[model samples]
Target: MYSTQGIEAIATVTELRSKTSALIDQAKTIKTGIMIQKNNEPEAVLLSYDLYLKLYKQLEKSSK
Candidate 1:
């Protein structure tokens, strides 16, 4: 599933590249959340399914 306001927090292109391994490592530690950006525009989200499904259910209800 795709998200519009996907991943509130973000990591820049450089941060993502230089810290790719670190990012994944962090992901394993905590429920990681990220919005990959290029030139300050949202490109995509990187988040765990646990958090995703939780928020997805919330959005689904709010739309009603």
Candidate 2:
């Protein structure tokens, strides 16, 4: 999972499983990714498609 200071939203695995649609909607509305935690540790991140593409492009450019 991507790590950065000041991440304001988080969800546990169980929460994500039960409220996938709602959490996704919230992420889109907030325009920020949600960090998913498992076993009380960060496991993955859920980012909107646009944001993922943007970050991917940035990484690609930086690696060039």
Candidate 3:
């Protein structure tokens, strides 16, 4: 099952623009992902490199 607990933070586009570096560092440290919002809607996701690769591998395996 997918869990929402992985989302450690949420940021608006403007906020993310200004704190991009810090937020990315925070995500890495926390080992969690960030949800990016635009116009109060979830438009994107920023995931840690390890988590992203893990998910990618899982998808690839499932597709095979």
Candidate number achieving the greatest TM-score relative to the actual structure: 2
Give one digit per residue, the lDDT tens place, for model 3 in 7-46. 7788889989999998888778666688888888777888
Query: Which tens-of-lDDT digit does each residue in 1-64 have in candidate 1?
Result: 4454534467779899899887665554555477778787777666766777887999999999
Candidate 1: give the clashing pairs: none
Off by over 4 Å in 2: 1-4
TM-score of each: 0.52, 0.85, 0.82
**lDDT of residue 25 for candidate 3:** 85
* Model 3 pairs whose backbones collide: none
Off by over 4 Å in 3: 1-6
Global lDDT of model 2: 0.84
Candidate 3 lDDT score relative to the true structure:
0.81
lDDT of 2 by residue, 1-64 (tens): 4564555699999999999999888777656688899998888888888888988999999999
Off by over 4 Å in 1: 1-8, 29-32, 49-64
TM-score ranking, high to low = 2, 3, 1
Backbone-clash count (model 1):
0
Residue 45 C-alpha lDDT in model 3: 82
